[model samples]
Target: MRRTLTAALSIAMVVALSGCTLVSTLAAGDTPTDTPTPEITGSGDSTTDPSPPDDGGSDVDGSGDDGAGDGPPAIPSDVPLALGEAGEIEGRGGNPVGTFQVDGVTTGFDDCVEPEEGLSYVQVDLTITAEDDLAAEEGSLDYATSFALFLLYVKGPNGEYLGDWLGHECVPSSEWIDDVGPGESATGSVWMSVQTPVDEGLIEWRYGHQNFVVPFP
Candidate 1:
């Protein structure tokens, strides 16, 4: 009777040990996946991070720039080029076209043309010597289109392009000449309207959907 009891006890112990072994093996293999999860950081998620690249990007400070596909190529808000400091013009193929200079800038000159209340008239003197026919067109430049197509702007004190420079239609007070052929030079003033009581800002010029700037000192 004692020997029967000992065999039974041994069988029970063996069965218990086998159950524990099987449970441990299953627990070891119960991982959801073999791949380790990627950690997220710094304006990104679900990807492993690497060393950042070194490349400059666009510099937009969120100022009011109407990016309504104005030009085929995107125009940037670069630093202002100085007045009378522009070099010889370059052709489409980058050949020298001609020369131009901002001979003078006059502000607050309200002669016969009456500006609206709280506004003033500013004029820019342009002298252009064109080697080609196209550059000559810039001499007696006329923007008969909407106000947005105006060629020149006198930036207000707030650093915004809130000025108006119409074509040479205000007749008697303007010395703006026309029919400037190639190899000839023309000097004229392009009048613009700026906010009154403005003592600072830049002057912006547009040509062929591109923009240029000349700061006010």
Candidate 2:
């Protein structure tokens, strides 16, 4: 129980520290009945934000509509992201968010606030790069995606999940040091911890209306 609450609190701190815009769902017009999200709200700055479709937020797939896609707009649906592979998405500000990769997941960080007992806090080494969209194909990704925040969760073998605007289960500690400008790249540490009891499971990046899974032990 300590691990669970501690993990939730730890990630909650990250959400507070990072300049993340609190969103109900990370994607477009749709819902994940099983996902738990954070209660913290964003700074109310939707400008250039890759927010949910319900917020009058524009789609990130370069489609003018509100991301009313059958699958995720950025990547094809159900395509799991492998370690070191980059998943790209365009922001609303005409800036493309690229080099979005999950480097690695680590636990038992010495600097973590959790007590060294039961399950320990997990950390995901992440990279979110902001790219220049000036050269983008005409009318392509006009909203040019920028790095806002990526919601995360851990999926059990049975398909159960946790974290974010709902409750902290496998939330990422992705508070950036500064705003990632075009042509600039930044690596943020994402934290995760499972409350229902398993650490070694599939980690999913809840991007907009789609989930890009990461195979992890």
Candidate 3:
């Protein structure tokens, strides 16, 4: 009996030792992993592409934009000019000559010249044509044309004259009409300062038909 009991105890000790060994082996085999393994397997080569870098640059040329250095070319418009009469008349000096004339007015010139010690200003009377008569010929004073006066320059005894005449530049519009009231006339003036020898006499304006020699002074 004693021998049998001892053998049974020894066997139990061996079984416990074996069980501990098995548990230790399982623990050793199990390891904590950072990345989870994918279940779906891909056959073809798998690759990860890196992100691209950022660049702050522009692709704007002169043709692409405006308002900066890229602006459109400038263009001029067709402007019309007018003078009072067509023949020579008594102007500043000894009844000069009148070259400018209105289309309809029968009178010689609707203009006057005033000489003031090397300075001169002319108050020239003009007629505006009616809308219906705007088409009248150049020589006819229809008195109702939608027109504006653009005086480029004038003729002086000394030479070509440019003045505050710029003030006479007409507003751009065919729709604007200058109406003539019956016998009453429309009037405008051109102012000028003498540049050349005021005594050159017989001052024919580059534009107007009238030539003024002025009261020889």
Candidate 4:
């Protein structure tokens, strides 16, 4: 009876160990997953999808985002070029009150000059007229009062284009007019000294997209 009970207990222990080994092998081979598990995080699960890129290859307006196409792009009109008009001086125009003709001619600007042997320089002359309401209202702001002329140029008469000369040079700036009154004419000259090979036509004049000699009007 003792030998038979011992044999029965040994059989039971073997069966229990075999069952545990089968369970571990199955768990290693077959994992439970309702969603994809990539190495990276933030990826969408089974139900959601990733977003599309901004620019579609063909540039067609309605390619991806929805049936509604992109709105029409803005188109700008060409304004007539006036005789002396610089078109716009930025910052100074658009004042509420004034007969402002940002229009003006650069009479002449000298090639790099030297007042003294050690002092080499260049100067630009311009004539501007502001009649009507703008002239009257210009006095209210002290900083907004001056008419600025920027001179764009090239180097050594042969080098690539160097930009505007008003503030780009070494010499002190010359102010033509600080403030103009109503029904009055404003005239002035500004000058600067820069280091470069000096020659005529080296400094190119620009008014909007147009390029030419000074004193256009």
Candidate 5:
């Protein structure tokens, strides 16, 4: 009887020891460990985000539509100049006359054969000098075609362009100069009829693709 009891106690002690070992192993396996996170770095072939698309907004260049219907380009600058102040003569034969200037501008003409209502006449006094002795053509200086080539117009205070006018009546018409030798000049007046009460305006002249402007007084 004593021997059997001792054997049974030995078996129980061995089983308890085995069960404790298994529990310890399971606890160790279930526990979590501290791990380090990886660092991120950019690649050499990385690309940047593209720019936004054009939304058809403001005009970067002055050539784009400004909401004001189609028309000639706006005035480059607002600098006021005078008619014939810095004019360059252009004609056949290398421009026999070189310098041209507007001596004066006269308005409110009292002598008009057929004056129309709501219109007034403006006379521009011009002095054209010859750079060299020009040969006389048909016993007179023939500048009718040259005068016709010039474009004369008016600009309102708001930069609106008025069409060209050609109905001129001068005592000595600019087209009828008798003769002009070197160091000599010819003086005359050219007239134009326009809307009355022109308080502030600009006289625009175009000659051979060149443009010039002068403030009207």
Candidate 6:
């Protein structure tokens, strides 16, 4: 009986140890799993940014933002050319008499003479060419004589007559061209002083009943 009791006690102790080991294994298996870490590529501020606005800036052709065409208006091919333009005028016998161009315009007085009160001297650089055919018919270009016959009429921007020619007193005499033969050209300066300064106006070259209006600079 003593032996049997001892053996029973030993068996109970072994069972208790085995149960403890099984409990430990089950507890370890039931533990909550750890979550995986996300992959980080770049630095801070990972949120996606918004796109930029489209301002109507200059175009590839260098036009304005308004998309208007290129530079100044196209000059008409008529007899009276615009400022800094050249054209020919038909004279007697239905032939082109001469080609004229207003090269430039100058204002203010030099050391030689002063302009009248409320007036300023405006000098127009004129270039006139007479081809061989016209020069043969009307003789050579005599500026001192024929220039007055051109009947140059100056008008303000509002079509008001500026005044008569101020004469060649202002410009140097050496700059004057008295004549030009066939196949030749003459360049001279014409001066005028108006009571009101001419900002933009028309210089009409009138002869007989025909007139050609040229714009001022």
In model 6, which regions exceed 4 Å deviation?
1-78, 109-114, 135-150, 177-181
Output the better candidate (1/2) by lDDT: 1
Pairs that collide, model 1: none
Task: Specify the highest-TM-score model's number.
Answer: 6
- Highest lDDT among the candidates is held by which one? 6
Per-residue error for 186 in candidate 6, Å, reads 1.7
lDDT of 6 by residue, 40-153 (tens): 877776376586557766376765566464432233222467766766744444466667677776655443354456666666777877666654354333222133423555
Q: Give Cα-based local distance difference scores for all models.
A: 0.58, 0.55, 0.35, 0.43, 0.56, 0.61
Give every collision pair in model 5: 81-214, 82-214
lDDT comparing candidate 6 with the true structure: 0.61
Better of 3 and 4 by TM-score: 4
Model 5, 12-76: lDDT tens per residue? 99999999998998988865466767886777543664866689886877777676744333332
Candidate 3 is scored at a TM of 0.23
The ten-residue window of minimal lDDT in model 1 covers: 140-149
- In the range 1-217, model 3's lDDT, one tens digit per residue, is 9999999999999999999998997889876567797797787644754765455344355454435643222222222233333332221222332223333211121222333344333322333322222233243221222223443233443544523232332323232224333222344333334333333222232212222222111
Candidate 1 C-alpha lDDT tens digits along 1-217: 9999999999999999999998998988875568887885686554655856555454466454556544334343343477777645443333555554566677766673545666667767776665644543333232111112255567764667667655434435446533334566677776776666455667765543335666665
Instruction: Order the candidate numbers by lDDT, best to worst.
Output: 6, 1, 5, 2, 4, 3
Candidate 4 vs candidate 6, TM-score winner: 6
Where does candidate 5 stray beyond 4 Å? 1-80, 83-86, 90-97, 130-150, 166-184
Cα error, candidate 3, residue 201 (Å): 6.8
Q: Indicate whether candidate 1 or candidate 4 has the larger TM-score.
A: 1
Candidate 1 yields a Cα-based lDDT of: 0.58
Q: Which TM-score value belongs to model 4?
A: 0.33
Please tell me which model should have the higher TM-score, number 1 or number 6.
6
Given candidate 2, what's the lDDT at residue 147?
Answer: 44
> Which is better, 3 or 5, measured by lDDT?
5
TM-score of 5: 0.43
